[model samples]
Target: MLWVKAFHILFVVSWFSGLFYLPRIFVNLALEKESVSRERLLLMARKLYRFMMMLSVPAVLLGAWLLWLQYGGSGSFKMPGWMHAKLTLVILAIGYSHACGAILKKFERGANTRSHTWYRWFNEVPVLMLLAIIILVVVKPF
Candidate 1:
């Protein structure tokens, strides 16, 4: 169980690394006017998104396993309010990641309409989610 928790944390950190940087890439993509530079940023963003998927899968699976280990009732876990809130943030984070993919696709199509300022603001969502999640996990203040 401790090992599972360790791995869960490990992968979560990995996922967050991509989550943090991909948006910075988007910011660069949004601001870049050179076609060659824009193409490069797009390639970087696509690869980072794929890496994020890889990290997220293991992070989520290990987290679920840890939850089961903590409260395995007929192979299911009954979570507390803190956990529920954390899960909600996790879901929102996933949605945000998916939305980033859609935005990336729009960039690929040369159809992105949002400004760099919009992307700079957009980049902050995961950071906020991460802070909330960490607080919930650590404090468990229900």
Candidate 2:
């Protein structure tokens, strides 16, 4: 269980690293005016999005594993309110990741219409999610 917990933490952190940076790349992509630079930024965003997907899969699976263990592998245990809240945030984070992919697709198709400032604000979402998740896990605030 400890090993699973450790790896869950590892994968979550790894996944969040990409979540934190990918939007910053979007900000640059929004700001870039030169065709060459735009293409470069798009390439970076594509690769990072793929890598984020890779990290997120294991993070989510390991999280589900932890939840299963919490249930004593029999769905007989009662989870605290905080765990439910954390799961909500996790789902939102996954949605946010998918949103990023959609935004990347828009950028790829030359259909992006948002400003760099918008993306800058978007970049803070994962930071806030991370904070809330950590608080829920550590403080277990119900």
Best-matching candidate per lDDT: 2
Cα-based lDDT for every prediction: 0.90, 0.95
Across residues 84-119, which tens digit of lDDT does each residue of candidate 1 receive?
999899899888888889988999999989998998
TM-score of candidate 1 to 2 decimals: 0.95
**In model 2, where do residues sit more than 4 Å from their true spots?**
72-74
lDDT of 2 at 9: 97
Pairs of residues at least 3 apart in sequence or in different chains that clash in candidate 2: none
Please, what are the lDDT tens digits per residue for candidate 2 over residues 16-108? 999999999999999998999999899999999999999999999998888888775775878889998998999999999999999999999
Native-structure RMSD, model 1: 1.3
Per TM-score, the best of the predicted structures is: 2
Clashes of each: 0, 0
